[model samples]
Target: MKKKDKFIIIDGNSLAYRAFFALPDSIMTISGIITNSVYGFTNMLLKIINDNKPTMLAVAFDSKKPTFRHKIFKDYKSDREKMPEDLASQFNLIYRVLDVFNIPKYQVEGYEADDLLGTLATQAKDKGIEVLIVTGDKDALQLVSENVKVIFTVKGISDVNIYGPEEVIDKYGIGPNYIADYFGLIGDKIDNIPGISGIGKKSAAKLINEFGFLEQILDRVDEIPAEKIKEKLKQDSEMAILSKNLATIDCNSPIRIDIEKCKLKKFDEKKVYELFEYLEFRKLWEKIKKMNLMEKSLKDENKFQSRTKLIVEEGELINLIEKIKNLKEISIQFLGSNNDCTGIAISIKPDVSFYIHIDSKEKEDRFFNLLKPILINKNIKKIMHNAKYQLKILFKKGIRLQGLIFDSYIASYLLNPHFREHKLSEIIQKYFGYIAFFNIYSNRAITIYCC
Candidate 1:
């Protein structure tokens, strides 16, 4: 039998709030636009995609308009603090990033993100698609069932706890169906839901496990062994019911699931790379590049093949130098260490590159001796990534590298001083719009592209 397709629904507001608090606000773009929330959210998104490999994905965002729960209680989430300006400023950027990924995002005026998640999850589950709900809110646990699981953000944005039916039972001492009942007994301070005066988690779990739900517990309140507990349940019965209603997620939200639209497909890698570059997400780009998530454009794909020639003979090396003798600039990359240099690749033009293998001491000495004039020429400009390392290696070989004009590593750092590390693959993808492959073996040499 074929495996069922996985559909993931994300609570965007809850995740953004959690990420905003988990990461430091010091993470901002060069223009002073705060990006901690977006950074964390995107990080979590990439990780989820890499790990789960979901076929269908969508994000549900909470609308600015008040939901039905607010109208019912008139004080729903009244105690919650206002959203921070820094986090609020990044919501548009987050939306743009989601668009670049082609992930469908929905926001209904009269429902919270939880309601949309519940509705979509139920719809997908009924259609035989495996559903995963990603959120930081515990209120989403009530939606857990056999076919649906909740990926609850436990701490920060990375640490998470997945909850199935049995996991929910283990955590709450009752099944997922009774999560709202438990919440009703013990009020949710985060949402300002008022439960019974003294009921807590232990009492709520016992009451839920004993009875069926909030109504059943209230109906059987008279049979309680403790007088005070029974009195609280009976006296505050209306409040308990209201709290449960508030905690319950509405599965019939005003929305429909478009499976085809939610299905993951190839996205515009160039647009995503440009956005990351503008946002100065150097490290995130590197992570995505390492994961091989970005697809190369047609132009790049054609430019990346069979253009590297290996020169093992003296005649070939002499011809290669003659071809590059008058070139204004060239790109160079050295493989291996100074003492045990394996090979060197040189690009005299956009379409052509040559790798000279260094097997024996004689070959290494001869190759450098033939190329030393160009290497030490002050007029022919040389470009590299991490020029300092290459300069050190060349100096150790008794050949001084001259006319060093451009270093992509330094350029990346200068572009974003906040970045901790600058990688050549990331820089190439960010600016050149594609990754250049560089592979070297113990006995064989492959051409490396430095453009």
Candidate 2:
């Protein structure tokens, strides 16, 4: 069977609102442009692209004008708080970022982003294309099906919960089609949807699971076991129906854009860099640099290739150290276990990579003694991944490692602090488009040139 194309439809307003509140308002640019929402959105967008490798994408935004739901029910979403000024200010900048990436964006004058997502997803599913709806809105759950999945943001941008038909059943105890009915009976105080007065989530799910939908429950209200619950359902029958109408997303919204228009393409790196600079996103700028470097390295593999050697014999170790004694710049990788210094790799130039193993205390002491002069030489630059970890291990061996100029570990942290670890392979793969063949003990030295 042929593979189906993957399309990701995002609810921009829902995610933007969630991101703004999830992050602190203090993430402001140097020019006083608040970027909490923009940063979160950018990260989420990149994460989805990297994780899913979607073939097409579109972000649907809510227009400033009131939606059709407002005309149907004047009090619809009336109780929701207005967007804060700081977050609102970042919307245009976010749009600019999307433009730089060449991603299609859509908004209808009288429809919510959810409706646009539903429409696109429904259309894609019909064409045998898999659809992934990304949002923080629970209303999107109604669109879940065999070909459509909803990725709901659980906490900020890092954690998410994906819902297929089975997940929807597991989470809500009803089929995807019953979500609107469930909300109709239980009510959504957040959206000010007035469901049945006495029904809660459990009651709503039980009724929907037992009788199927809201109309069925209402039609047989008299058969309900609880008299009080039945009385409330009878009294609020009209409101329940109205709530369902409001909660139901219009899957056939008149969205006219062709799916081909949403194909993913290379972004304008220069423009993206300029935007990052203008926003003063220093950490994000580093990431952009890495991405650009990776692309370049992939396009020209030979340009980043270098020679390397691992030394285990004592004679070979001394000779290599002697060869690069006068080198002005060098990179080092100290390999150790249980705080015991075990081996080291040194790369003085792109063509020269050396590694030495310390098999015993005598060998370890002899290696450090021979290399200590170069390490202390202020004129010579030393580079390594996580110099502190190396320094700590050397400290335990009664040696002081110094003259360090670049530490890729701290650099990686500053670039993306959310990552759990900045391993050598991860850094190399991220910046070079392929995993490094050399392990932590072997390739730690050459990472100095990754930036």
Candidate 3:
């Protein structure tokens, strides 16, 4: 199917509520209202938005009632505890977030989100749209089809398993129909489905493969499978039937959702900022600001062109070393492909911000070492963002840099780890809120002259 026809539906309440409890609850407003779930959910939504670049999206929520699956099996999910009052209360904020992002949210009166997802999956398939249903629940696997795929969230909700026919086959060793059958034989303790007494996943799969269907296995019970298997299947005939029914998702669930209605629209940054301000997300609020929610920003004075002049000429080495040693604290920035021997640029800031090129190893080593005394000096401070990588390089060279203060990188991350990559350029932009380096700022400098 064409890309435009693609649709993505998320199990919002399931994942959002999960993210809420996954992180520490220390993130709160000064008033003692918790915002950890809000922040984490927002970050997750932002990442999904950026990655999927979905043309259409919607978040589906589950109803409070026991689903039809549970009616068929009373003990289904009976083990689950009730939702926390704090998390339940936070649902209002998530609802408002949906409004801010301009994405439609849906919650049926009497169905779980999984049933809604299955309903939507069936509808999207009819419309010729490739559907991607994302959730942490593996039970959603029953919805997999040629036109619809299930991407189960794993590894702390960062990655997903894209289950098409092949992936489903590879993983469960059964098709969706057989999947319900497979689970029927094995039973799910969480959902409380009970299979045959002696039957497990392996035996179930083997039997299903041999007979091709659950009814078929029982139809030819005398085809002489193991006596143990035959006796168990005969005795728990009711359980086997009930297990299959419980495992099978109701694609024909009465949840009447209009799939076309889930089409996405541009996010409402203003609304987002308003809620962000209410929750005290100062840094994220500013990030939304720079995204130009107003569409055009005011004219400012910090515009300066970065002219990288590659110096490949010979014999200008001594003069450069002398100039660097005479300066105190250099602001250094490198630009090139290979990080190790990449082209380097260094300059001293405040009045004499002249950038010198370093194309040779001799130059790279010399400039890095020149700041050692300042880096190790308790009275002096050196600043960097994502200092771990850069510091590792320096440490490997036996250049132990201690007493350094102000890592703009970590500061930027502590501000918003979800906004940008932990790169220096991003931190500089976040903290300074402008491209200050081209003129207002410069690169890392290495040492001694009182500039």
Best-fitting candidate, scored by lDDT: 1
Instruction: Report the lDDT tens digits of candidate 3 across residue range 119-201.
Output: 87887788787888988877788788888888787755566678888888888778765787787778887676777767777
Name model 3 segments beyond 4 Å from true.
Answer: 1-3, 255-260, 282-451
RMSD of 3: 10.1
How do the residues 286-343 of candidate 2 rate in per-residue lDDT, one tens digit apiece? 6655543222323333343445565777788778877777778888887766456766
Counted clashes in each candidate structure: 0, 1, 12
| Residue 92 displacement in candidate 3 (angstroms) | 1.5
The predictions' CA RMSDs to the true structure, in order, are 3.0, 7.3, 10.1
Please say which candidate is ahead in TM-score: 1 or 2: 1
Model 2: lowest-lDDT 10 consecutive positions: 292-301
- State in Å the error of residue 134, model 3: 0.6
Question: For every model shown, what is its TM-score relative to the native structure?
Answer: 0.88, 0.67, 0.64
Task: Indicate the residue-level lDDT of 134 in model 2.
Answer: 96
